[model samples]
Target: MATSRGEFSSSFGFIMAAAGSAIGLGNIWGFPTQTAQNGGAAFVLVYLVLAFVIGYPLLMAEFIIGRHSRSNPVGAYRAISGGKPFVPVGYFGIIVAGLILSFYSILAGWMVAYAVEPFFKLIGADDMAAWTVNQGNLSRNILFTSIFYLLTIGIIIGGVKSGIEKWSSRLMPTLIFMMILLTIYVLTLSGASDGLKVYLLPDFNKITDAQLILSALGQSFFSLSLGVGTMLVYGSYIANKENLVKLGVFVTLADIAIAFLAGLLIIPAMYVAANTGTEIFDEGGNLISGPTLVFQILPELFNSMGAIGVPAALVFFILMSIAALTSSISMLEVPVSYAVDTRNLQRKASTWVIGGFFWAISIILVIYFDKLFGLVVSFTTQYSQPLLGLVICIFIGWVMNRNSVLEELKKGNPEVANSLFMKVWPFFVRIVSPLLIVIVFLQSLNVF
Candidate 1:
């Protein structure tokens, strides 16, 4: 059981895998749109602080516990608690992963559909191109959703170094390069300066707003892939010689950088859209957000560019699809790793079985699009994720001995004992992170 479970072949592979997990559809679509909907740079300022202060500590909780136990979230919890009730939390995390991927695959499918539409458009098959991007086409949605799942499953069936790491290394750089070029080009367009000003110049007064703070905190958690055991599973694969503290910082920064760049690319593009007579805001004056902003608003903006629009839209949706794929692979791995490590299942078979199950759920959600889709999304991400994260924090800070965590950190860097991380992190993970998460969770429910 111990020997068969794969380890990341190098620090680079792990960072690429882990960071790729963290940088997903949210960073590109949700984060920038949320920034615009909130107070723009004010929300970015708050999110920047929360990502490190709140997100990092919880992130390391997964890292320390995962490396110490060297197992999936379930095994890690049981190992830490010495066969106590905390084991259920691990199973709960696995359930959360499935539920998230169930709905998430649908969104990724939309990206894939949009990506494919440009090819049809290029071939002068305008009706086919129109059909691909039409949200009303259930067959199109289901088809692309299955395609996304197959793409994710294809990578996972190859195992760690060859599968997750290899694709992530190629995909992350490609995502970044395309992101930078798009940002530069969009910035060159007229009226993008308005969005640029909104993104870069903070409205300091709104930083103190409670809603912005809670939203930033929630985004930080979501963006880092914490509480879902994605990070925990990734952490389990890290080579023992790696400095986890350094690695954690690298992944977090990479996630943050991509999200920040998304703000640069996307928000500016929104203003550019507005300049071309597209409505950038809703009837209520809020910045259009979520799928509407991604699917409709942004696509309209692309279409207005005439002949250049086809290839540009292709590259944009492909970038979105790449971001979605990188993250989806990690989500799928949570269940696959559990089946492999604890259930004595094979990785390839486990991936297909679990991946197929989630795809089935995605199909169900697609069929019941008006009903189950949003419910599943809210349940998985908004509610269950923070609950799982809170539990993990409690496990490490309270259940596991403080010394045990210190010892795990010492594996890659002996200097961790004397470092500031040793002095501050234990306390932060135990108290600060849980409290912050609870606040965010409650705020999400409108209890405040």
Candidate 2:
């Protein structure tokens, strides 16, 4: 294991940084989409359970591995497994990190474009439909994508303490504050209560559907930033004295709160739009999915708000841009840590080289989004994430020596070492978590 690396300035810094990673586009965008598509509160209920059941244990496994090895993903695996055979797991994580960043940066770029829309007078223009049309223009997307990439790379190049932790501590609070403010304003809108009921009230029939359950499971994993080595990489920077369990709980709760608040804002806003004669539902009366809900539907919702819509749209996109940046910084850090640890490169050099490569790739993705975007997202999120998560669970629960794990867990909380969790967690990780992840993987394949 490497002896030298940056440590979080405080436990608060670590939690905030980790929470920032957890609270990203997945929370602000994906969670609301899934909730709208699934059974709303029913999906939220399952998602919460799964977050603790599968997400927390698996998160603990990654954290223990990182803190134990005291290195990057690749080095951590090698260090814990005593090298050879298992080292590729770490490499796999690095590759997954890069894959996620590629597509993630594209979406984040859209947020940047939207954030600038008010300044460009695009939000409430008479030709608002043209604004959406222009968003699809290849050159425009590339410009914004490149701009977002540069922002991400700039933060990552600042290194951990100066870059990630510092910004996370600042931006996370701002994100939350924005969400609360937006939620308050949105709730006061006419017909906003109708959206809130749809979001919070569970339809038992929809909740019982297999597809919705699977979606909730998937969202739980994705929202936690698990299965991509993000948590593992961040875990390496945590102070030895910090309690992993406490930290994990805080991060998980914060992520859930952000998503819930987003639901409050988005669902109510959608209803408010409906009150203003916008079609939030299709002819079949189903809520629209994915980009429709975000790029098209939400824009219409804000537009219906009259003059308030402009500033609302601005704040919403700014909040989204911040969310995207926090997550992107973590993704960039994975490969940067690998280069610094395994390849012995300087942090700034690794960040620039890796960030530049992804920036170019993100531009390609933006240009060919219709053909390649969905394919990349499906492969990475469906196949890669669950598969990697399964491998990590197996390695930590079965391959790595249990005594070593206990020793690591005992670092800050001796009580936890002897507690019931110490006894049950390994068993759950070994048998239960992997099985559920396999179910998620198969569900992704439509193999049910």
Candidate 3:
């Protein structure tokens, strides 16, 4: 009863899923925190450079392996590396994907709660103070967390083509349309010039810290879903005829554009709302946190916009919800696809079972151990994600045969086989990629 190795119905569907994976909570929430902490425009520069160097080529490699192997991450790694010792790296994907989704579901649940904040006046003025004050409370946090789990389960029960794909196809376009509209509205505010200055103005002196550079690079990878098996799993469903290089570049551009645009809308609004010039950095020198930036910062911005605040607030949250759901579908796709491909499970059964497990796990995260949100964050970042990513990068870099990899890359772009770009790419794959990851790992662990 296992689902067959299915092909995407069209190139667009493949792009949507891949783009969906790239455009998740990280792009929306994580990107802004990194930008604000790292001195806005300066961080943007470092982020773009990292994206081109470390991110884009690896993304292309994932697609090549996926299409060439026509298998999930584990099987794909085994097939592509042949009898090489690096095949165990495929298990790294499963471990990272599972751990990521667990904590990620908790954050996604928060998005769902924010979307519904208006219903209880939890968003406006005095009501907001009470909500913010109780942000760490156990009961309220538990309720919202449970809601997140249920929503994820509901979507995952729909299966891939029906559940994940259908929802993303509808949601992604809606997200794009709404964001553009929201951007236009934000730009028209009376104080928008000041806000724009805060967002776009470069402050190089402040951005030189090595931590900021590292944060920017990390955001670039996380935002693109690069380190995880997300892109590889996405590549598995790709049709042979699709122009993969074109698709990879397009998706990367779209993901980066959205993150950049998100900052434009938010930072400008932050300035206009504060009225007095609020220093972008906090007094403690910690960058503003994510939930604080979104729930508190945005509501204040909306209030400053005069009579337009109410409708705009609704639109902004609605847009966020759509973006969030689009990305959530992609995360859910990883596990469900693996269950079907590896365990010989029916699509519906796989979807529900995997989705339900994540949901239940998130409830424990949100409800029982609410105090450990920081720990969850630490686990994903300092340990789980980097470890999983390091293994995969080394495998692609050192283990996969040069001739076979060249052949796969050539299929999508004829010049890739013989060009100078190909010459430099494998060198990075074999050496630079692994070395950089090792450095990042040690840095995260304070080992060096």
Give the candidate number with the greatest lDDT. 1
What does candidate 2's lDDT look like per residue over 149-201, in tens digits? 89988888877789998999999999999999999999998999998888888
Total backbone collisions for each predicted model: 0, 0, 1
lDDT of 3 by residue, 1-448 (tens): 2135676666777777778778876677677667766777888888888776667777877777777777677777666645345555666566556667777766665666666655455345657534623556666566666666566666667755666667667777877788888888777766777667656777899777888777776776667776667787778777666777788888888888888888777766666666644444477875465777776777767666656775787678777766766666666667777777767788777777777776666667766565765786687667766666666666666666777777766665767766766777777656765666666777778775
Question: Candidate 3, residue 435: CA error in Å?
Answer: 2.5
Residue 264 in candidate 3, Cα distance off native in Å: 0.7
Which has the higher lDDT value, candidate number 2 or candidate number 3? 2
Residue-level lDDT tens digits of model 1 in 1-448: 3345878888888888898999988888789877876788899888988898889998898988888888988888777755368888889899999889899899999999999999998889999988998898899989999999999999999998889999998998999999998888889888899999888887878888888888888999989999989999988888789899999889889989899999999889999999999998888988888888898888988888888878889899999999999999999999998998888888889999999998999999999999999898889888998899998888888888878888889999999999998888888888999999999889879899
* TM-score per candidate: 0.98, 0.95, 0.88
Q: What is the model-wide C-alpha lDDT for candidate 3?
A: 0.70
TM-score of 1: 0.98
Question: Global lDDT of each model?
Answer: 0.89, 0.85, 0.70
Q: How far is candidate 1 from the true structure (C-alpha RMSD, Å)?
A: 1.1
The Cα error of candidate 3 at residue 390, in Å, is: 2.1
| Clash-forming residue pairs, model 3 | 397-429
lDDT of 3 at 63: 77
Q: Which stretches of candidate 1 lie over 4 Å from their true place?
A: 1-3
